[model samples]
Target: MRARHGGPAFRRLILEDPACGFDARDARVTHNNPNEEHGRLLEACAAGDHGALQTLYRLEGARLLGVVQRIVQDRALAEDIIHDAFVNIWTKAHTFDAERGSGKTWIFSVARHLALNHVRRQYREVTVDDTTAEQLDAERSLTASAEIEDTFDWQGRGDLDRCLKALEPERRNCLFHAYVDGYSHSEIAERLDRPLGTVKAWIKRSLQSLRECLS
Candidate 1:
């Protein structure tokens, strides 16, 4: 039977097939611990094991596509981004460092950034002509330079910093890009490679989370 997207059948197909090139030992490990499974799969991918990469895709492809689709709001574009994301994961698999973070998080971040970048590029294309865009780029550089100074001088050593630390890294990054960098929602979305709506929600929820944390 053909596996359906995100369906149990798909998972069974991946998990049950030794021909997928994940041996019996790998299957046992995968069944026992999720993080370890992902880490091992990534290592295998780094070693040029295409089957390992396929296994990873079968495990996470649906969710990754969902995440990208939500951000880009276009199924075709999201699918393209997912394809690119997997290509990136395959190419950059050697760069995966378990000491720094989980493989799952790294994978998701790669896909998320791809989706965000695609939308941001599209936004820039329709929003301005070449001359005006160039002017804006120059202005942004100057503004960024000034903001760098301001960010250091302000010193986020207060409760705010502590509170901000309570947020997920992605959400925290969104806040900094929006408030410190003076980026609009679309700009922040572009910068963070998140969906515009997701960026907005992140900023809003981050603010709320910070307030609660401080209070």
Candidate 2:
């Protein structure tokens, strides 16, 4: 789903570089536990409170840009994707179900998906052979739910990056295609020229191995 264009003020609030204004560290100074506030604030946004949406931008805009930039690897394009992401978050806030995942996860998922969509459209043929995949911490928020949702405390596990690197390139490619690129099992199978069942099993086993390594 694409985000509709927002007004000028909202556009400036999001599209401007984080270095020029918003900083995650500054947001944390006043809000010690920002994630905890996301659900309530998102509900407020759903109720048509622009201020609540701004608060969310202040809390997550920079980090969300980081997530997008890492994937798209373009500063200006990442900012554009982040702008679209927040617009989607504002417009789609009402659809969020707290039961499905945390509000932070929902918003990040919105941004992440937009970035992935951009990558797929621009770089669909690029293969992830021996290239080290982007860190899975980029997807930590989405991993907590069964299909995709888990914590991203990479610092807690010193070897998390090593563990990811240890996985076979094809297997790691499958995980990134599924999680980072937001591709479905069937789509991944078709893209990678593997059977659907094999793609599904590889994702499952790869996830289990990562969890075990982290444990």
Candidate 3:
């Protein structure tokens, strides 16, 4: 099914049985040290190495598809988003700053945001009234202002995971939804059945708490 859209070589690479999906286990085995390997691959990609990009796709493609599929809930749509996300990563490789976060996190963020945008756009198109849509847009702007501008060195902080675990569950859930699920304040509110104002406050406070805890 994926073959019709690519060259013979790509077709061969992607033609594994649809039923068996891409084996993440196999991909992991190919790298003894995943983080270091991914970092090197990103560096190579930044240096204009196409083969590095291909290697990254081979390693992370299946997991990226799995993430998009869970969010978009459609195999075809997920595949399309993954394609776009790869193209994005290729173009934006030079922008990746290792000091900010891990290369793997950046890669997954690219794919996850694309999937989130797709689903959010579809939802807006069908269900939003003009007034509510405008409200949401304004809310998004304000929410962006409140977002933590500096990326934490998440991988370098040994206590980061433990700190996150210490957060109140509601606050932690809000943080995860915002960062991991790519949810807006309004979306988090709806998902958590909390007031929009409350969600926004929780997220703001959570970011501050995380920074303080990690510091």
Model 3 gets an lDDT of 0.70
Residue lDDT tens for model 1, 138-207: 5443343222122223336554776765666666667665433334576765765445555555677788
Report clashes for each candidate as comma-separated counts: 1, 7, 0
Looking at candidate 1, the ten consecutive residues that score lowest on lDDT are 145-154
TM-score of each candidate? 0.51, 0.54, 0.62
TM-score: model 1 vs. ground truth: 0.51
- Select the stronger candidate by lDDT from 1 and 3: 3
What lDDT does each candidate get? 0.67, 0.69, 0.70
lDDT digits (tens) for residues 2-85 of candidate 3: 111223543355433457554434232254578767777788888988778878898899999987876776676678789899
lDDT of 3 at 57: 93
| Candidate 1 stretches greater than 4 Å from native | 1-29, 125-215
lDDT for model 1, please: 0.67
lDDT of 2 by residue, 1-215 (tens): 22223346544665344467543442322465566689878898899987778888887888998888766666767888887898899899999988887899899999998877776774444444211332322253234233322222233434567788667677777876666545666577677656555666678889999998888
Q: With candidate 1 superimposed using the best TM-score fit, by how many Å does residue 146's alpha carbon deviate from the native?
A: 35
Top-TM-score candidate index: 3
Give the worst 10-residue stretch by lDDT in candidate 3.
1-10
